[model samples]
Target: MSNFEFQLAYTVKPHKPERDETDAALTRQHLREKLGLDTVEHIETTLLGSITLNNSTLADRKREAEKLVHDYIHDALKELRVLSTVKFYGCLMVDGLGPAIRFDILPK
Candidate 1:
């Protein structure tokens, strides 16, 4: 079996309302500089998981990787109850024997 590493980043809806989009960054900075809370958006969440496939070919791996990512997106949409964009980054073999593949999948 071939082991794959996956990092999924997603931004969910119903994010805290700030004065504007810029305020999100300003708020984080203010908290970090003044209140010492280094937190960005309390809305976004990341899902990290790995998949072990029975195949070894790179072509097969790529197909499986994309399918896995789409599956995550579907789950997020259904369970999180929000539109989210999932980016698939740093897909690599667990044994560190080949080049890694990275890509992004935007929301529909």
Candidate 2:
């Protein structure tokens, strides 16, 4: 089992009429189902938008997980037909080891 914590800062190009709570709920559900994440929480007071994920199998492999998430977000945006961009940051702790890996995503 792996412990992963992710912090995502994001912006949707065209704002939608839906409330932030509704958008957050939908995003959480989508990520939980698509990535098998145990936790997906939307953080308030973040610039534009933010989301966090904790304790997930997705972080079993640190580097791989980072890449997976980066690519996943890209594909998800395309799939949703939404012009959005995300800046992903994460810290992976395996078996109680503190901060095994810390990374930030950069545009390709």
Candidate 3:
């Protein structure tokens, strides 16, 4: 299993400012389910949000995990129209083998 810590930066449509919290909650739940993550949390304090994904087989590889997360967010945006550009920085835990591999998933 692999653990991932993600720092999320996203924009919501201008008109939907009031739904920010609701949208964020729904996004977190969606990611948890879609990624089959054991744990997902929204640790947002600043304008940027921090998310940690734990115990996920699907996220075992850094490159694949980045693509999966990016694609999932793209698909989720179709239903959750409040989301605009979404970007993230992901750190893949190396299980004490060495330093974690860091990757960035940027908006298209």
CA lDDT of each prediction against the hidden true structure: 0.44, 0.42, 0.45
Ranking by lDDT: 3, 1, 2
Taking the tens digit of each residue's C-alpha lDDT, what string does model 1 give over 8-77? 4433222334423343344323323443222334533333456676667767766677666666544534
Model 2: runs farther than 4 Å from truth? 1-19, 36-64, 81-90, 94-108
Q: After superposition, how far is residue 78 of candidate 3 from its true place, in Å?
A: 9.4
In model 3, which range of ten residues has the least summed lDDT? 43-52
lDDT at position 41, candidate 1: 45
**What TM-score does candidate 3 get on C-alpha atoms?**
0.37
Per-residue C-alpha lDDT of model 3 across residues 1-108, encoded as one tens digit per residue: 444444333332222445455665665556545544444245431122224344345444544545555565566655655344333444544332235445544434
Best by lDDT: 3
Candidate 3 runs further than 4 Å off: 1-26, 40-84
lDDT of 2: 0.42
Please give the lDDT score at residue 88 for candidate 3: 40
Pairs of residues at least 3 apart in sequence or in different chains that clash in candidate 2: none
Among all windows of 10 consecutive residues in model 1, the one with the lowest summed lDDT is: 85-94
For candidate 1, report its TM-score: 0.42
Clashing pairs in 3: none
Expressed as tens digits, the lDDT of each residue in 1-108 for candidate 2 is 333345443433223344243444454345445544444345521222123344354444545555555566656645643323333343434333245455544333
Clashes of 1: 0
